[model samples]
Target: MASLVLTDGSQLTSDSQHLGMYSSPTASLVLTDSSQLTSDSQHLGMYSSPVASLVLTDGSQLTSDSQHLGIYSSPVASLVLTDISQLTYDSQHLADWCPLGKDTYFRKFEIYSMAWQNEINLDNVVLAAASYGGPVAVVRDRKRFIKVQTTGKPVISIYTASGRQMSSIVWTGGQIIHLGWSSTEDLLCVQNDGCVLAYDMFGTYLHTFGMGQEAKDTNIIEAKIFASVNGTGVVVLTSSYRFFLVNNVKEPKVRQLAEVAGLTVPPSSWCVISEDRHTRVLMARGSDLYLLKHSEQHAFPVGLDLRENTKSVVEMAVSHNNRHVALFTDLGHLWIGSADMRKKYCEFDTKCPSRPRQLVWCGTEAVVGHWDTVLLVVNRQGEFINYSYDSPVHLLPEMDGVRVLSAFTHEMIQKVPLVVQQIFRINSTEPGSYLLEASKQFQKRSHRSDEYIRLVKDQLNVAVRQCIDAAGYEFDPSNQMMLIRAAQFGKSFVPDIDSEPYVKMCRTLRVLNAGNNHTENLTCGAWCGLVKFGNFWYN
Candidate 1:
């Protein structure tokens, strides 16, 4: 038998059967094992914790843990329920961990990781990344060998910043010579015949375009798809050693670039930087480099004072902004300077001829290049911050840092931001650093904490913002929590500063840490997803 119940006009029956269902005339009610509910869906609060607490729909919770401590919802999710017996880090602890260099502009640091050792064979992978902390795209490098050997079409996959698999697509179209991403996250697939196809993350074709009749007839030997303020752009190199350009993928405005004399071999490497007025392409030959500014089908040859034995360029990279350019030569020399070469920062040599597999700019502050598993993060000056990986590595450019991807783990190498340095560097003496120390001591009920607070009372607001910005740059979750808590503690003495920034940092870090958890649990294999995003302009 079955029985029905109502709200306020209901009969409470004990034994109608286990299959009984209940309903109210004016409200929609649901029943669980041990809890009762009301019809007001707008104020819903439900949970299954052993402590019998409730979590509201809007993410507020009234749990015993917080009530016992007499504190409201924490600004930080990770620090809310933490035990007091555990100590995360001292205010000065991070200074010893971050490395300092001769680059007076800023300090560089090797970020510790919440990374996982991957099972993928990254040596054969060609990688790309979306700008502003986007996903990484991994494709099998078909040009690594002289002979094309494969059982079937290669696999292209995408993964998040934390290495969680997003999607995998089998390459069933024409041979995939190169894979990149558009500003809006579409994967641009460039083929040998100058055909450019756009696909979503799952590899479903959206649109296609050609690189003009010249590229189709001569067949493209190499091509580069870069970012533009308007949209995605493309550049193609034909077997006949000529260059073709498309300003945007959406409009497909193809233009042929001027030839640089009787050159036959593909120039070592080249990059594009899109500007407000026009796009400029920078190409480097053995010992010479040329800047191709469209509008006058003429390539301007630029002279340089590269070091004696460091000519014969092999690889080159330009920063996300068109402000800086980097060049690598056969003599193991790296030239980093303003795009015009007017302000030469440094010309350091690696002293090896193996040629770096990749050279990329890290947030305009440094250049990151890698060979096999060895990566060197050289600031605009000569400070080299080297990181050794357990397996093959790939560098992905981001707005804040460079994402180092590998079969073993995914990591980030970036400059220790100025605000963070002020708060954590050894002997900083910055008010924010003093505030952090004060917060730690105050938690211990020491009078010394009051003295430290008085030192930074005038600049309490600035101290809070510095800690917030530094927390944004941190790679570790625990470190993020500690710094934020210190900021929260420091702000308590001052009321003029807003809490919104700290609140936002807490939520963003929480989301990032949650993503890290997913990355840690990734099982199966690397062929699951392909991810990459970048912005490009000709320089």
Candidate 2:
């Protein structure tokens, strides 16, 4: 019953009763026995060993071995696959949409008399850009004007939401020099010659003041007429050095606030009040920055001196948010600082690599256009995003893509996307030259697509002949998408076929092959054949 037989090699009887103790060579395999080997490692391709166990390189057993990497990823951060049919605007600089919501905020437009270039007279430059409520008034050349420049010229043009030129005003007299809009009554102030003209946005003449004054010893270089705090149709005047609270004595319908003087100290280049509607702080410019509070019908000056640098402020504007202030110096330095005007945040040397000019913050972003090309956006933290386009143009926001509103004077209107406006918004920080150059580069790249079409012409005959066969030439998967787009658009997509990349793409598409080998699914099939060579494509 327990017979044992051991010859030169190895043998076994089918029914040996004592076979349990008759041991043979012990296999080194650990995971599964030889009989279960197929089940244990069936996932392995082309197994070379007589016996082996499955173990992942990470020391863990893989549940499944079937996995292929996804085909697309974000061009920059994440992949956004847009359905080809849903493309819009063929935007050259299509960035992600800004997350800012729809809230009504004030946008200020400054009208500049760019007399440095072609000497366009200040009066002829229609300054009708800031009329959000009605045709805002403008002071330029020798006249205090209202609503100018419709189709052209020194005429004030009014605009409506329905793309209608609602109203306009034309003045044939005195050169206007300064203008301000009162948010309270929607009134406009036009200071020209030696008088100030006040009017409603509808070209309704309300009142006039300071008429025919003597031009001797009066250092009123810049002036703004604000509305009374009580809003009983009264006016308050502010100048470079003092505040004059005045009302229309002729109309008898005016009220006067407190006219305070001796508020501003000397050696100050520029001064402005805190833009806060309540608790407004009076700011004075001297060798140092000081805060002033208006109370008890008097200008009370505070003794806080914030001395940051020696550069003088030639031009300055506070943000509507009252968070930050921008300063431009005669040296062509664009400096940003806190709303308190205490500390300097950062400074950009905008002096033309040739000559320096002025800096103006047109509400949302800062622009330095007179000297060279520089557009800047300064955030509260003092960081900047700058985009520089190669032209001296003013930027205006085109809200609905239909109506173009000017920032200054709110007068001049254009149809096309204003290059000066949007391009400057893009240049918040120096995008280096590459991003700036890319806008132009896109056009060249689009033209080069034509070359791709011509190169594929020869390959197309063969590809259509065999709609299912493998592509003949060496295939590159990177051009797979380009080939697909080319096939879809055909000759229209690419007019030039002389480029090498196009030739390579055509060869990869198997456009040269004949017979039913070239299939509509040619991209997939071609990618599969090229996968052996480590090139892959995804639709």
Candidate 3:
């Protein structure tokens, strides 16, 4: 029997490491083990209490009292041993505080709101909300010093869906001519000096670029930002009345566009449309509209002419799909047509003779025209719906709807996607709705689940897909879980169903909810509550 002893609390041993011992009030060394120990005393004795020790054995004889195993009790002492979860939540019925319901079952969530009531003056605020539930970027009191320079600078603030301010950057730079968000969530601050600065989600300064030497040296008059396949693109009209394009923000690579012939000043209204891998600028000069592109600069033929009563275009907006457009004229004549102006959908008279404050597309189906406190949405059929906002307002067009931003509250005005309405609408015998009912019955352990499944067995995949998609539009974890559970339950009924879509949506909602669960950690971002209303009012 050999043993080693040390007084300086150091020792050396062979590979087997069998002849070392250490003792202390917190711990005491035992017999042979591969791990080496150093202490003032080296002697053979059993380990003491209070100091937890790691054990490695195949259910063999254990010598320590540290046998409790749980997430809280386990000490992270080994690389191989880690944490785990062992619970499964009941996700069938949605919990209280589910998303607000519009009409029968359309879900409308309170994505964001002002920190305080009437805190923001929407007239002075330049607001932009990125599509697909992206963050909103705001530049307060933006319409300041347009004619002349001022010492005041409006702060640039970015907020998430929960009204939590992700970042607030002091605007000490030049004149912020435009504040917009890129497709990748980078906030682009366009200055009058034609410098475009990019910032990340956390408000970190990315590099800066110029629209063009013509734009920078001669100065930019007006700018329009659009989303492109590669990155966010910007088109600027230089002081020389010439157009320039930065097709991709990442590389910047500026390209000057064809000039509109015989044009002396800026047009009344214009928009950038991206389609078929090509981008074009649609500008209206009085009643004559033109499409300016690298290939051609020609007069855009208005298929439905208002030649007798045509007035100057006041405001115009293109749909997100880049296929349709909404043109609001000074005479309150609103026209919905193709981007090329070749095919006209319908023409609706707003009956408000004055120019509209804002013109935007509502998910490619309707044209939203706002004048003062009254807002009107005229669909392609020329039928319209009116809305009222008592305060200053800004319109944010989305892939699904147009978001209305005022000083006190934020609301979305969108026609519910047809799939959502068909799936969850009351008394609907749609295949997707039946599948959801079947899943609910399955959760209750009723054999009716099988019967319901058999009814839609031919379209089970479509039904599962609809549930998965509806889950994305829901913010409430309980409601999201209910939709996802219905999807899962429906998936089990179809053996050949691809589980990838459902699994991906569940994972996405999990991550989204985890980040959105910051309600408890907020200092000023509060839950402004929700209103279950805004049923579809379409033609």
Q: Which candidate number maximizes lDDT? A: 1
Writing each residue's lDDT as its tens digit, candidate 3 over 1-539 gives 22232222234434214422221223322222223445422332333122223322212222221111221111111111111122222231221111222332112234455553434456666777665445667776545544424555667777764455678787778888787878667889888888999887678898899876667788877888898767689988877887778888888888776667788877888889888778888887887777778665544434447636776887889887889988887777888888777788887777787887788887767778888998787777777667666778777777666777666666666665555556644334567777776776677687867877887889888888888877776555665666688888788777877788776666655555554553522211111111112111110
Give the C-alpha miss distance for residue 102 in model 3, angstroms. 18
Number of the candidate with higher lDDT, 1 or 2: 1
Could you give the C-alpha RMSD of every candidate to the true structure, in order shown? 18.4, 24.2, 22.6
lDDT of each residue in 1-539, candidate 2, tens digit only: 22333221122234333332333332111221222222323422322222222222211122211111021111111111122223222221222122122211112221221213332223244333331222323324334444545534455443332123445567543445455544332334444343556555565677766522332123334443422333322222334343332333233232222223644543234334334342233333432343433344554444333335544445655543445566555465566766665676677665433333333343333322333455444433344444443543333222111112222221121111122122223221212111222222233464433333343454543322121121122122222332233233432323553344334545545532211122211112212224224243221
TM-score of 3: 0.69
lDDT of 1 by residue, 1-23 (tens): 22223222133234223211322
State which candidate, 1 or 2, has the greater TM-score: 1
Alpha-carbon deviation at 433 in model 1, angstroms: 1.1
Give the TM-scores of the predictions, in the order they appear: 0.74, 0.40, 0.69
The candidate 2 region of ten consecutive residues with least summed lDDT is 66-75
